[model samples]
Target: MDDAHRTRWTRRTLDWLRTEVGSALLLVGVVLVALAWANSPFSGAYEHLWELPVHVDAGDLRFDMDLHHWVNDGLMVLFFFVVGLEVRQELAVGALRQRNRRLVPLVAGALGVLTPAAVYLVIAGRDAPTGWGVVIGTDTAFLLGVLALVGPAMSNQLRIFLLTLSVVDDFIAVTVIGTVYSDDVRPGPLVLAAACLLALWLLGRAREWRSTPYVLVVVVLWGATVQAGVHPSLAGMLAGLLVPAASPEREDVVRAKHLFRSYWQSPNAGVARVVGLGLARSISVNHRLHEQLRTPVSLVVVPVFAFANAGIDLRGGALGEAFGSTVLWGVVAGLVAGKLVGISLGAWAAVRAGLGELPDGVGPGSVVGGAALSGIGFTVSLLIADLAFEDEADTQAAAIGVLVAMVLSSLVGAFAFRVARVRFGEHSADLPVTLTPDVDVERDHLRGPAGAPYTVVEYLDFQCPFCARATGMGQDLADHFGDQIRYVVRHLPLEDVHPQAFGAALAAEAAHRQGAFWEMHDVLFANQARLEPDDLRGYALELGLDVERFDRDMADETLAERVRAHAESARASGAQGTPTFFLNGVRNQGSHDARTLIAALEESLPEAAVRRRS
Candidate 1:
């Protein structure tokens, strides 16, 4: 090569290297500073800062929470809010805008989420498997950072594909975090958060408030949320969504340019230049800021979170023990095996059914491989681990499980991509696929006895106050309907929040063994607050049971198993919360009044009443 050509190439390479190094340094600095602050002698101060109490009052309800909790629970809402914005944006204008573009990522993401969870469940079973949701997320920033290091060796399309998949992965993670990882909520903080979000929307519409004011309000909302027992990071996601992504005067720039062109030949050329330049400059600055606001959140917030949460203690026998844990193995299997299997099967089925297609240069092998990689759940997995296991040992085990699964999935994905590249030579057309038809088969089956017109399914947690309220409403509905509806009581005990819920369920099942399920169910719901292990005997005696038989049944493993089976069935039927009702076999979550119950039952009934012939 000529000397001038070499010099030019070297300069360009050097500049690119400089930019990459600069970003790396900034990331490293943040990580180092956070670690130092967290581990230093001044760590107590850092911890104390998060623990500082903040209080808010609205009428009769007063709420307060510590600073650390505010950041995790409340601020994180904004994190999810931004995530929602990204998902919306992707569906509207980005890679996922097309069916073919979406299929690969969607299928891959589903596999990523489901596999790790299933693996976790299989390894840990019902009790310990609660953490299954934890190991089903992908850290987009880390994945992109790794990709960036590979530079031009990676295809531009592949980069875009990876980014799109990661964004979708983030959406799934945020939804899981919001729905699955929450505690029994207090109405005060929830209402406050909603009000704040509404206020933010109004401010955006007014377009008068600066981002600083919004940020401050967000901090306050975070504080309220922390006191409310919610993870605070959600507040950040909510706030980000309310921040405007486009300025009000975006159209004015085009109008001004056209007006300036007309003025170029007129007598007011000098004045036009001055006014047009000023307006253009202002518009440019506003547009730039607005664009920055709309930049992908996965690039910023996720990386910061990973840095903060990813640090392992790495001392004692903790590392070895984590590796040895079934929880960890379960997480690994779920992410690595379950994700690959579920995603591939779902995608193949979709293709065969004629509903979707694959991306250009991507094949089934590549898609499945990428799906496997998507199972590298790091962020959401850790959050689930925190929610699922209160024990420190269990938490560590889950973390190890997440770490292992992520590493395995990433390696597998990279290898698969390489293999696809070699074999397919990077095909440039999108591959199409078909989706399976959705049928109400489960709904039909749950209707009970071939000719049953309507099925009413009630999901109740033994310790829920709302479930107690629902018990009375449900009884009234059954009596009012009078053999018109089949009431199927499903156990759904919120065990994490109510420690005695499972025990109460066991007592109810024991009562069922003596053909007095309704009597026991009503008694248990009515006296949910007073239920103790000893209290079951008194209830059994009042119901005129064989006290010995009742006691024996209460202690029976079979009773506990039955309760667990009911709980699992409720979950599979999409009942996440207590007092969830399903009319005509359709799930309806949350407590309702007698009027609402009547309405639901009425809707479920056949249009024509069946007449019985005596």
Candidate 2:
């Protein structure tokens, strides 16, 4: 990942968090309104409204359901579908793609699921074992919202960890719903549903891009699943899983760009449609659907589901009875205590076993706080309560339990973060802000006068497209500042994403041996599409260096070590992705455009110089 891509990802993540937080606040308000209406003089009306029968009949396709059932069994499919889309994307290219990255969260989330059920079983003690699944899920919206409210100011790493864990939790919860909570299966419809799913698989295998086909097939699959005595929502998840997800290919992007340019020149309906389709095809179906559905799922489906389901009447001593009910206490203890212990223990064990490490800047305390917040199981918990219990009283008890767990979990998470800050002195919530091992004019690659008043350093990947765009910024800044600016470039090649990057970094080091480092740098960035060993050798030969010496230097372990050391220094300086810039000793936190770089460099100058520039 380059800095531009990483920055966009970070911005998207923050945007997602904000959206989820707003959705959570809306869900919370809806829940409160529901509770108020349920307990108010219009209590009967509340029940009557949801219980109102809704019927849909279309040429032998007959359906009869209450308003509540329509929301749960129908509209909520979109919710599960969106969740499945996210899971597929993550497994394909997002955070969960790497096994090492998935390890800690996978273990922690699995334990987080099981431990809660165990707690529920122990506490419920033969009273309501069927309700154990209620505690298995963490409501991601509410969890994120609560984390925002109680967690440290800069908690990007912790938020990412918790989000990954929550995704795992959701996957498990849906699996349990499909298998454990569904009605008895029927052979004929089961086979039909299987056939429909097979059709979905075929569509995926064919890499179908049109949404209409997928939507129609998924709807038919849902009906088949319902008839098969499976949860229809599971069909949604399964359908979503079958949708192909992959990063956009460079060729596809270039084609889309060309199509857009054509549309810009033509400005007609035919050209516009071509551009739209081209741009849509540049992204995966999974991403396209996720973008289209996430807002509706978050803003409407979830809130409507809450309104329909969460209106439990706490009248006639129901609240007092809930306090005494084992089911209520079971859910509360299961989520609040079990999640904390299980997540912490699982993470600790994973680290001990060398399975995976926590995200950078996340500590034991942050883990604990995140674990506590994992107890907030509002949405899916309520759904499970509806599925698990036949008795209304037990269901109400579980709902109350979920509400109480949410409050207790929030308080516990707050306390844990507070303790982490005060007692442990783990105050900083972001990665290190200062550059490590200050730039050395003698040791570093310098582009201008060594004694320049203003200094700019960049940790860069040679194969990264974003870094390639930034390659000329050094010369631009030098031009703008005359000899007053010194530009330093350090290798931080991201080998996982950019496989050719490490070798390219080594090529640069080899070129440095022949005093043509900048020449080789420009060539490599220019020919980013070709950075193999032969390409590097050809570029070296074109630079008029002794190819023999360059080859010898490229083979030197010292050059590789030098590159690795620079990567380590990049990490230490909070540069997770390249090209990461430092103005003076501080990390640059703005855009990487040459104009922006020039302005930032001007600001980094001495006060007198800055004033003169102003």
If scored against the real structure, what TM-score would every candidate get? 0.53, 0.87
Q: Model 2: how far is 398 from its true place, Å?
A: 0.9
Q: For candidate 1, give the lDDT.
A: 0.62
Q: Could you tell me the C-alpha RMSD of candidate 2 in Å?
A: 5.7
After TM-score superposition, what is the CA distance of residue 573 in candidate 2 from its true location, in Å?
A: 2.5
Q: What lDDT, from 0 to 1, does candidate 2 have?
A: 0.87
List clash counts for every candidate, in order: 46, 1
The candidate that achieves the highest TM-score relative to the unseen native structure: 2
Q: Write model 1 residue lDDT over 1-614, tens digit each, in one string.
A: 99999999998754543443334444445655655675566766655665699876767656565754444454445456555455545654467766766775576566556665667787876547567667666655445444444222433445565566666566666656666677887788788888887887787677633455566677677666665666655665556546554322424654555666667657486868765564644442223333454333333554455455555454568788888778777778877788777767766776776667654445675565556656656656666676778778878788767767767876776676666667865432122111111113332112234344556666778777655243356667656766665566667788876888888888878877787877887788767678888887898899998999988888899778777777767655556567776666565532366677677666545562342221
The 0-to-1 C-alpha lDDT of every candidate, in the order given, reads: 0.62, 0.87
Clashes of 2: 1
> Which stretches of model 1 miss by more than 4 angstroms?
1-71, 74-81, 96-104, 148-154, 198-224, 238-250, 256-304, 427-614
Q: lDDT per residue, candidate 2, 239-307, as tens digits?
A: 888888998776787788799889888999999999999999888888998998887788789889999
